[model samples]
Target: MWSTEDVARDAARRQGRGLSTAQVAEKVAEAARREQETRRQLDAPTETEIGPFATDPEHLAQLWAAKHTEWRRIAALLKTSGEQAYDPDRDAQGVTWAQERHARRQGALDRHAAWMRERQDARDELRTQIWLPADTSRRLRAIAARAGLQPEQVITQLADHVRMDEDGAVVVAPFTPHRVEGS
Candidate 1:
């Protein structure tokens, strides 16, 4: 058996040169960050709306509490059902590795599915993506700061002039002025 650092060191040796220990750790951390970002991007909905729009804050908090309760219930179930509570290996026993991790992931997914069904009708918000050139983004940020507004707020105000449909397509007509209600 070998530690992760040992495996990383061996991998460095096979690459024809040894990387510094810090370099190896940095690489591992970078890989973890990339994986996390990938998961977030993949799970995120394509269209979303930011709120404080129509619903009452107290109602939103109650809904959030319900979701939290679901999570806690799921966690308790998972804790009870997961790998026998303790391990005999390595003498300093705790959670087992590998196979149990897969089990945990599957359990979480199942729980999430159930929770989603429970809260399906309670979902809110819409999301949209924006692409801007690097220089343009910098200018926009500066302008936003000057106006004491976030870049997104600035964009929201400007969006009022453009005629866009629910499908996010822009109408090829003359500009119009209107307040774009939050979804």
Candidate 2:
């Protein structure tokens, strides 16, 4: 992954210029300032102002279905492997092989849920009549994680830079672009 510095240096190198670490730090500081401003603009004074924190019915049903499917799959796996997976010695440590398998399966399910969340966010945007990819939301989440901030806290930090396409997009300008290989 290219850090902000890597990207700046890459751009400068392409333009036949030598970029310094101080320049990168300055740019990062500027970004931090911009993000702070955006966060202020995007702030919702109250939870009610934001509306609908829970998943919508359709997506909720999908999540339940997925959860059920995963539960059955993991049970079946356990049924088959529990014999080999469980060890009396590990049970003393409060970590049975069955528990290990369950953890692994649960981790996979969690990953799937994470991806599903991205899709669900995009769908929700569309339902509200916007066309932003969930990837933009993921970028928001990433920014929040990196900055030790809440998603809503920094959401509007770059709003001024957004350019909406025709048909009304959800959000503009992901912090990071998702590029497909071999366009």
Candidate 3:
């Protein structure tokens, strides 16, 4: 992982002129500032941008599929060009590199699809919401930590032990805490 300073130093060295420590530091700072500005420009949304489509699964899928097709077309073209200039000795490593790159790209798309499916599934699942006092929430978290369970899981399990009394009061059975190995 090369830092801005390393890149600046390398560029200066290539120019065949030795720079003082202060000059090298100044160059590194200038390079870093420019890099940051470029990143900001890239991250900012464009005026011609389409819908955000974050909550629209079908539209997001279509976008992803289109991008995947474009990547596949580019990869195929590169492969065709490489084959046209074949050199067994020189391209043995190139073949391995190309295969690895293709696999990585495919894996990224596969992972994205899996994540989209998870988001869709989550939307379909039933859920309940309740508000608890800040102190009670903290206590629940502590209990969950001691039991090696998530706070939500602790609450779900507690629901099984809750009952209603004749006087319309809620009563809960004694909770049996799970013993953690180190605790």
Candidate 4:
């Protein structure tokens, strides 16, 4: 694989070609514009079909169960690794690789925690904005209780169905419909 230094050298060589300074600057600007445009396109939301918003308590429950199972699996793996047994005296002064690995793991955990907190906050906010009937809310809460999730999870999942597409057109998610007959 080409190293960063190699890449820089290649770029310098390309710049040192017969092209004038103004030409090089123009080429760089054009490349930057193309990169920005590509990123914008990638970030843009695609068109989606809108349908009724229906929240399946069973599905939510299954999802929660799966997440719990995955978490347990991860915990088991960590336990087997013996790394979970912390040792304060584990010196990293001579173990640069281990120190780097530990730093990466810590960074990943920190990022995961931050993402989880942000997701929880967003779910809470979404729940407050949901305008489901009292009976529906009650049913949802009941389902959530059975599925090991908070009522807010049901509300947030349903809320996700009510969103606009890139063109500002209302696009409802198929799974979470606006109304369920007996919900």
Candidate 5:
């Protein structure tokens, strides 16, 4: 089999030149090293460039807002040039790389915003504070655990089973309290 060095040497011989196999090999190795360095530089993020903006979201937002006009101009240019939306597989570099990465991050941000709103809505209920004996608190927690619910949920369900009389003092109910061993 003709190895790469052998082929390179044969080509050099056919060209009637004084080039040696070691020289060809060295040039090829240098080219490979340069290409590797170029790729590394392209892929590595500059911490000094992104660190401050990444640490402060409000600052990042202000910067983005400030760039609105520039963004609009870029959008118009792209539109006029008939450039399509980013496709990760086809456009792995250049402007489209930023577009694809920002789109994915924005999607995640939107999902987190929705989840925060949901949690806020769920917590929009009457807030109350009451002191119970340590033993009572322990029993309440135990009951909640047995029913696979929060302590508040257990109280809410029990309250659901009760009705106040006209006097607002006498209450009739079907629930019977059960004793739980204290830990």
Candidate 6:
């Protein structure tokens, strides 16, 4: 995090050259401008058009697997090199840390899977409800307007509030109690 001014002052002191405050400031400004230009050049994209497969998922997965394999190979080499290495007893603490990290990842994956299933179920239910033989699409649209939501949103809400059992059947019932007749 050294600033351009710090670098310029250190340079002047090392050179045994006395620079006025204004001269030092000017030097720092010039260095900063050059650094900005260098960053801009580095960040500029290439003019050549890139192919879509440059970031394909299968390629990325292969790259990640190769990277991990190489890292493990390097670690094994370092262990065998007789260089001062970490004590196995001290590093045994890593097992608990790794287990905790793995458990967290499993929980996240499970939650994501459940969410995906719920979304798919909601979509199926929405399609069925909206396409019922007794009702037209316009009636479904009116219901959606009454609920202050898009038709899809209303359908998802209903599906989430209702779910089928493992026996491949759903029991339909009113979700909320109706007001008494005289109320």
Q: Best-fitting candidate, measured by lDDT?
A: 3
Name the TM-score of candidate 5: 0.27
Q: Which is superior by TM-score, 2 or 4?
A: 4
lDDT of 5 by residue, 113-145 (tens): 999999998898666887999999999999888
Model 4 agreement with the true structure over 1-183: per-residue lDDT tens digits = 333333333333334244443444454455455445544544673454435784333443443343333333333433454453222233232134335555766898999999999999988662236588999878987877775667776565656668999999987676632333344
lDDT of 6 by residue, 37-152 (tens): 54454467456555874543333344334333333332343355433432322333333444555576689899999999999998865244435645666776787787666766
| C-alpha lDDT of all candidate models, in order | 0.49, 0.46, 0.55, 0.50, 0.51, 0.48
By TM-score, the candidates rank as: 3, 5, 6, 1, 4, 2
Q: List the residue pairs that clash in candidate 4.
A: 52-177, 52-178, 53-176, 53-177, 53-178, 54-176, 54-177
Best by TM-score: 3
TM-score of 3: 0.28
Give the higher-TM-score candidate: 3 or 6. Answer: 3
Weakest 10 consecutive residues of candidate 4 by summed lDDT: 85-94
Ranking by lDDT: 3, 5, 4, 1, 6, 2
Model 2 lDDT tens row, 1-183: 333333333332332223233443444454455445444544533343444674344433343343333333333443454433322232322234335555766888999999999998988662222355799878778877877666654644454457767878756665642322442
Candidate RMSDs in order: 25.9, 31.2, 18.6, 26.6, 19.4, 18.6
Candidate 4: residue 78 Cα off by (Å): 61
Stretches of candidate 4 off by over 4 Å are: 1-132, 165-169, 175-183
Candidate 4 CA-lDDT value: 0.50
If scored against the real structure, what TM-score would every candidate get?
A: 0.23, 0.20, 0.28, 0.22, 0.27, 0.26
Model 3 residue 164 lDDT score: 98
Which residue ranges in model 1 land beyond 4 Å of their true spot? 1-125, 164-183
Candidate 3, poorest ten consecutive residues by summed lDDT: 1-10
